[model samples]
Target: MVRASTPSTWLQGLDIPSQLFGTTGGSDYELYEEDDEFVLTIDMPGFETDEIALAWDDGMLNVAADHTDENRGRKKTYHRRFRFPKTVDDEGIAAEYTNGVLEVRLPTADSTAQGTEIPLEG
Candidate 1:
């Protein structure tokens, strides 16, 4: 019996796995740093206000959206993900969905810290 030839390793490198997995979606994100806080603007079209969920855990911010059955009859698939710069305080963190866009506001470290500074002298 004759043996089959294997494809080159370089061919695998050129493979676009995101397209094959069907996780590709269009999204725009903007991160801004202010004196008291950092604001994150995420663009999520075709999503409802109640279907989005945001959480902070283990120095990471997680955002997920679950579409309802209203579009179940249509052929659609989405698997987009966004990673935040730093973990935010889960308390008082609010998410607002408007006009098919999700806006998440995160308070900075300085804003969350309270108390007086200690003086050191030598």
Candidate 2:
């Protein structure tokens, strides 16, 4: 099985693709800290805004979307959870979906996330 030599918690709990399933590298979502907040963006095409659901509990944020086509007899579902290092201002969280992209802004008290990135050795 192939495995990615990446940090377990890239950008503080950002989940990358599993190499066990023949995938590797960074996560599907883009996460960065700026303006005292962590901005996360994920490309989730083919799912309507009404079908997507988001919830926050403590430091964990859950994103889920499901779409079913009766005529085609098919269902598509996507779900992911993100955990942040700093205490998130849950009330300040905002999300927007447009053109098959989902963007979420998680406000944090810190300007940078905690932890040091380990340098990879050749």
Candidate 3:
């Protein structure tokens, strides 16, 4: 017998339940700050290196994947959304995928410009 999901259970899984009724499509992510960069980690169970996409536009970072696992007959969809802090640097971003996890490194602006000095008395 197939069991149906309740409203509460469904809402709990969604990225933005209040706005979008069901669980956020696709995967879940974690963001953290290190010494000189902002890091984003996402869980992508069955994705390949080529299936993932990462981009930065209008000061926003977008990560997505089109993954399919035929053996398990699983087709996952995602619509998760997140907002970054103003301190995050949009340039000098890098991403990598390994062991079903995607890691993104965004260098902080201050960190990127650490060695440049201006001559005020020229």
Best by TM-score: 2
- Candidate 3 C-alpha lDDT tens digits along 8-93: 65556766545454433322667777888878788887778888777777657877778777898887654344456555677678
In model 2, what lDDT does residue 64 have? Answer: 96
lDDT tens digits, residues 8-121, model 2? 455335554555544333346778888788898888999999999999997899999999989999999988887876578888999999999999999885446556888999
Q: Model 1 segments beyond 4 Å from truth?
A: 1-27, 68-72, 75-87, 111-122
- Where does the lowest 10-residue lDDT sum fall in candidate 1? 18-27
Q: After superposition, which runs of candidate 2 have C-alpha atoms over 4 Å from their true positions?
A: 1-27, 110-122
Candidate 3: regions farther than 4 A off: 1-27, 71-73, 111-122
Weakest 10 consecutive residues of candidate 3 by summed lDDT: 1-10
Tens digits of per-residue lDDT, candidate 1, 15-100, equal 75644634223325666766555566677787776667776775466777767565566432334444544535556566787887
- Which ten contiguous residues of candidate 2 have the minimum total lDDT? 1-10
Best candidate, lDDT-wise? 2
Please give me the total number of clashing residue pairs in predicted model 1.
0
Ranking by lDDT: 2, 3, 1
In the predicted model 1, the residue pairs found to clash are: none
Cα error, residue 98 of model 3, in Å, equals 0.3
